[model samples]
Target: MDNNRLATKPHYQILDGLRGVAAIIVVFFHLAEPLASNHLDNIVNHGYLAVDFFFLLSGYVIGYAYDDRWHTFTVAGFLRRRFERLQPLVVLGMTLGAIGFYFTDSTIWPLIHTVPLWKLLVVLLIGYTVLPVPLSMDIRGWQEMHPLNSVAWSLFFEYIANILYAIGIRKLSTKALACFVVLAAAVLLHFAVTNANGDVTGGWTLNFEHMRVGITRTIFPFFAGLLLCRVTKPVYIKHAFLWCSLLVAVVLFMPRIGGATHLWANGLYESFCIIIVFPLIVYIGAGGVVHSKTESKICTFFGKLSYPLYITHYVLVYFYVAWISNHNGITLKQAWPYALLTLAGTIVLAYASLKLFDEPVRAWLRKKLK
Candidate 1:
């Protein structure tokens, strides 16, 4: 096989950069989570919304790259491709999390000392496959399948989306896809408004309610992105990348709207953001052209870094969160220096993994799989 013939499809470079931007914000948002009494008051309040944006991006990219290729692409081939691209970082993230686990002992996860080494290793092995562990096997008190690495839950739903696409959704006509999107959107609305917290958060743990939250979050944006790809006619825009990036930042950083008295207000806002705002951002990003070499390079770097950074940064967060616990709830002002260090350290670690491990391993797999 000619390696050149197997080159990846061209991406929306600005969208890639925006993905990295959101990933970075998510890191900061996690840092701020310990500070707020609840979701309504948290600084960087809507940071969790980044995952929805990511799902939208994933759908657009997947549909753009592979929808037409299905004439020759098998389910097995698609699954293998996704696994090869994603699994390397998953392994590295779990390994890093495991290495840092003992260091994260604190009040939040008090059972860490009693968790057997064998059980941790078992979770690590399962994490490599992105499989959710049963609650009985949850070594950590949090009931997360990947106890050492909590973020893998989204990756689990990501794989589910890919599997659905490969098996059936990819074959749907544009009209059918639109219908699916509408249905998903309605479910998302229902999930958001009816929740006690009145937001789209809390899908990390493995349970019936959380599973509904996870599926609702996954379906709407993913299908809506695919629908947008099918229907979109690109429009030229000035400074689209900047504008779209700003839109994302503002949406994520906006102070929580509609407090306890008006929970429905926040729910409507989140629903609107996911079903409407995010896809618009992706549309602008896709249609907008890169105007300079520097912008192109930045997008390239971000595209390369986004997944690695998202997957690996939470390991550092575990330590940071534990440090907060050990200090008896340190304020953000007191924690700024260490928080800055963790932020810098995560970027360095992500870059190292991308260059020294992720790229090399992925390249080798592509060759062998070719």
Candidate 2:
């Protein structure tokens, strides 16, 4: 979610900066993913949780920006505003994926060379709308919602949450909202703890199980974030950005808990982080003030970079993963240089997308809609 949506509202500088931090870690997480045999041993073990953090942030920012505007804001208006903020980059990201798809052929994607140009175009067109394609239409081997740009799966779920919020969830009494959040949290906990892998991953596919995972991941965090914004009082916290950013990084960087024998242990840990630690971080981040010139500039830069970086970076990751898969037995040591390049390249691209496409396009849409 773009805090740019809060143009006239008070911005949570630290939350934006923290989002930037999480976005960057996600890049490294993907980079290191090819190195691991499974989620258990991935060097960036808990990095997938960043999606949950994003859901929470999205909810909080939506509530902060729109909760009081219900008198003037219709559901259509709210959804329009959200689509304006979110869809532009989604289009750009998927386009980038389509452009790179054939070029990134590797042993991992044996069918990449076989995919016809017309089918590629078809998938690209669907991806542009950020809607999930059925498995039968999967261009890539992975049964991803947006095979061209895998990250769009999360965006799809987010849109679902957004629609739900606009239609009815926004009208819930405060007590009712809290009860809903509680029930949602319980479902999330059960889903996480009972899973075979002990982590809340795998929502990319468009199946009943994956759909359940996607919905489960979305509801509690988004509404809990909404609840937080409505009820929490912000007390000034010194160095809140630094403290909160560090806290987020530490949780994401933590090694996987309880090896194969006790998958539920890792699941419990992830649930704890999502349900408890994430809200506390948001509370502190919301309460924070930029202390100095350097801090202010850092917050502004990071806040602007966060969403674009997240949405667009995965296109490059498709190539990076392809490169790694083509080269078998390539150690982390050997891959760091290329990984670093992908990181730097994606950051540069994300910044450019922010300045060139996202801001200009959003400004144009705002004027047109106004």
Best by lDDT: 2
TM-score of each model, in listed order: 0.97, 0.97
- Candidate 1 segments exceeding 4 Å error: 1-5
In candidate 1, what are the lDDT values of residues 1-370, reduced to their tens digit?
Answer: 3332455788889989999999999999988887777677889999999999999999999889877777665788889889888999999999999898888888988788888899888888988888888888787788886887889899999999999988999889999899889999999998888888889986777799788889899988987888899899778898988999999999999888888888888888999999999999999999899999999999889889999999999999998888887888578899989989999988999999999999999989988886
Angstrom error of the Cα, residue 6, model 2: value is 9.9
- The list of candidate 2 runs beyond 4 A from truth reads 1-7
TM-score of 2: 0.97
lDDT of each: 0.89, 0.91
Cα misplacement distance, residue 28 of candidate 2 (Å) = 0.9
Question: Which window of ten consecutive residues has the lowest lDDT sum in model 1?
Answer: 1-10
